[model samples]
Target: MDANSFLMGGGGAPTAKFPTPGTVVGGHITEPPQVEQQRDIQSGEKKFWNDGNPMMQLVVTVQTDQRDPAIDEDDGKRRIFVKGQMKNAVADAVRAASAKGLEVGGILRVRYTHDGEQKQRGYSAPKQYEAHYTPAAAAQLQNQPAATAPAAPPAQAYGQVPPGVNPVTGEISAQAPAGLDPQQYAAAQQNPNTAALLHQVPPQPGPQAGGEPPF
Candidate 1:
């Protein structure tokens, strides 16, 4: 074909099978409100859409007070459908957030694109959209204080100890443990278990030439 005809008709429309138009949405993720699974009509096999893949619908709480027209202040939230077509996009977003040490509570922005008609075996699937996510920096994340190590539990005062026997030393001084007399208590305090053992003295000879037998 001629160059002009090739340029005009051979290539056909530049956007014959174009990507669906999309919009950007920014918010924090929430649990999905609903889920849907589909099966093929002809073969009765499991089937998914959105470029032949299933999607996860996530409800997101949009950042309010930012005056973004895309966000509905009255609703304060929006929904995003994530699918396999945007797998790399979602992974990149998650990696970005992870690199920043962020998590589910972190802010993210997603580009949502709608799907065209798809029909099979006299069955027509409803229109759907897919999400492509990106990490969104927020003032909240930036201004959050670094987690302090619980202030080291406020170093206990000099003589104030927990109300229990010391596990390491195995010492118990709680009211002398019931049945011991004051002397026994003192002795037990000096040597734990001394009160628990009985001692017996054997008989000794009366005396030696210059020394009394000590018993």
Candidate 2:
């Protein structure tokens, strides 16, 4: 089996649970939120609400503060399964952060505030939640990594000259350079020994690097 398939054999991160009111969990979102249909625990079948609509839950995986020893092992990751009012609260928080939607690297905090009113007998009241969000930039500032010196450019290979320079004479080539394509070679031939042909390639930005949580 491939590495990914082998890793998938292990169970996912533990689901964050709110045992009682006033429970709070705060962390950085590790990935985009996922919407999945709810399933029955006993039958393992898809579930629906009373109105016959499919029941769905928003799953958000977070790299949480290491405050809870029970589930903070390994990578300190937790999966939050949100539905009902909790989903709405999370959406509002994301909007308050000026984000179009929940995104990876954003900060999120959720609180189990209280229980909703119970309308029928023999039924439990629904749990209610509140949430807040901080954009990635703001969160980075709060837990900024130490600044490091910029890296120097890599040295060119020996005997490997730049496009416009001749290797033997170490001067501008009067003809098209060795590595140019047909089009570029044609253009170079038309403008040989000109400073305009000696273009300096711009440096490209590398992928954004992720930092370890200060938690």
Candidate 3:
């Protein structure tokens, strides 16, 4: 079949395969089918910051301001994109730059130029932990003990104990032990399952320099 559209001076391109789920057809008017396999991804991480040093991996989709899908000439292969870079990028440490107004879309940037040089642009999404966070944070969060402070001392008969305090506090307060636990956290991270689940980054086999995943 052939569908004609009055856009970009009008052209009747070849027909597209039946639309799939999560696939938008035109003007944010997503075809009803765009609801299948995409269910598992909660705010899919189209943009991801991998094992440190500012590199990023991302998924992307695109459309014109008129909301027309960029259908390819041949297989109707419209390239969806999630913009990324490792310069003095907003998310210097990771893709979480958007939360702090970092990374263009909080996770990724979307753009197209005259001749692909960015003559046009806009934000695509938030700095999703799912997308823009460093794999390190994932490895770290599992073992890092949820960003807590040192376990406060007992209710000093004299001084007032801090909040989140318990009756008798142990020496190893939630404040992670410097030498051992951090190392253990580092080690636990590279365990394939843990790495995949926590940070969305994979763990590499063989030996690493400091037990860390090069993150």
Candidate 4:
């Protein structure tokens, strides 16, 4: 290769010392009213892309009298935007709200507090704290005789219903149950032998009784 000469004559164009003709990626553009969801790390936001995705966002929802187009979100999802070094803000916010029982649709406002640590209170009181060997309140738990939960429509005892049984209507008590089922209570009543073995409400509806949803 000649140091001074312009053309050393290798027919093909020589490669530039510094990169020339910057790399250009080929992509097809879609028409309006269509979008693809993608994460945006630069702006610390999650968004749906439209067309070639050059713009940050587009007006997705129709304008309503209740809300201005400026604040209306493009999709059904909430506009969860976090800027300035927000890595786990969304996840932390969701967990905190869940711990406090604030659901997704419910409006929850978050305020930070800088309070110093304080005393911790226990759930059971009067006997504010339990000693290492102390027994629980219920005499039945103390006995621990193999028992079943209270049953529904429990057999009436003493013409007046039991603590868990509603006297007027045969409904099981909503409060803590003595036994697991209606049958168990009936068994206890019919054969006094098992009366002391009953332990829970049979018919007060809850997650256990409710059928599971589609997985």
Candidate 5:
């Protein structure tokens, strides 16, 4: 191994641990969401659902607030594993930000609100969360000089455009991007910001509906 690599802080951020209920994590997202296959811990095999569909998770890394003791990292970096209801929470947060999906430098805060109703007797109740997101541009505006801040763009009406199309050019694509489903493609086209976000990140399988826990 190269000795210089050690000085460069090569290892990635440690996964953020939710030690208890009501824990809150807030930070600026450092990268786009990463989609990875879910694996069984003991068997070390990829996980699948009852219908034979593969399970997946979205990984998001954030530069956390140093004061948040729950993170417990000197570097204030933490990785969040999002699945099931957590995925929906994060996606909803992103949508509320009025930009796209999770974007680099976006502000994200999530709280472990409570446990959900247990669906099965043996399995634990799913962990529920509340998330909020602020777009990078919007966050930066707070610090920008008033005279230098750019004017906001006018909103465009996209309701008439077909799914998987560009409203400005009125161009429709013949097929969805690789890995995106029809529903996702339709949603992406409906919102230009979402389409831009989709272009930046590779398409991944949609989250599965269940009581899977968030880590």
Candidate 6:
């Protein structure tokens, strides 16, 4: 029978066969773990399938320089699926590397085990799996410089007023000279010696009229 006949007769659907369990792969971490939301391709809907899942992912580039013909010929990179529990492993690796963490050139080893079958429709690979990371002793691992701390800015002391400025918010205000008492300072601010007088009233002509006109 044809492909459709076989499927209708309960033979099986076509699926991509993956490597068996207990396969080991070695590679350098080309991409660090980043938390990203999983979304549907067609409908653009978020997919949260796993319990206690963070939806983080990483990528590994297979070491082709090890002279392995299989890896050298085939595609050298693969995307790793990360879950909440697996996030711990990634954290440990990063902590071990210190400043470098899981940066681009860090080396790692992974062991493959059967994860489960994918139930999503129109997915070619039904029998999906995941990778388990381990510290690898490779020459490519290098230490990165530790991040430097930022310098602290100078702060003004409380209640210490600056020259001709308010102490609280650094605004302009009238100020008395140094070593002056509080009451003296207030008096000096209220009454200044060099203030200019605008206008003056002259004494009226004393009793100009004989009948005291409009005193």
Clashes of each: 0, 0, 17, 15, 0, 0
Residue range 58-77, candidate 2, lDDT tens digits: 88888876546554455777
- What's the residue-level lDDT of 105 in candidate 5? 77
Assess each prediction's global lDDT (C-alpha) against the native: 0.44, 0.73, 0.31, 0.32, 0.75, 0.45
- Rank by lDDT, descending? 5, 2, 6, 1, 4, 3
RMSD of each candidate relative to the true structure:
18.8, 20.6, 28.0, 28.6, 29.7, 21.7
For candidate 4, lDDT tens digit of each residue in 1-215? 12222376522212111112222111111112122244465894655435555333211111112223553342222222122112133235435544432222233221222232334575222111110111122222545677787765534655445555666776655433333455455435445565454433244344545677422
Candidate ranking under TM-score, highest first, comes to 2, 5, 6, 1, 4, 3
Question: Model 1, residue 186: what's the lDDT?
Answer: 45
Q: Give the TM-score of candidate 1.
A: 0.31
Candidate 5 weakest ten by summed lDDT: 152-161
Pick the winner on TM-score between candidates 5 and 6: 5
TM-score of 5: 0.57
Q: State every prediction's TM-score relative to the real structure.
A: 0.31, 0.59, 0.16, 0.17, 0.57, 0.33
CA displacement after TM-score superposition, residue 200 of candidate 6 (Å): 99
Question: Could you tell which candidate, 2 or 4, scores higher by lDDT?
Answer: 2
Report the lDDT of model 1 for residue 71: 34
Model 1, range 146-185, lDDT digits (tens) per residue?
8777643322233233223453454543434345533454
Model 5, range 1-215, lDDT digits (tens) per residue? 12343589665567776667889886888767678788887998999999999999988888876545554546887888888998899889987778767778788888899999999999989999989998888877866777876764533442555555665664544356666766567677668667666666654434468856332
Clashes of 3: 17
Q: Would you list the clashing residue pairs of candidate 6?
A: none
lDDT of 6 by residue, 1-215 (tens): 23563678942212112366665555665544344565565896766656955444433344422333544344455444444434455566556655444545556554545555556778543333344343443433344455798864433343234334554565545434344543445444434351121012222233356667443
Regions of model 3 farther than 4 Å from truth: 1-79, 82-106, 109-145, 148-151, 161-215
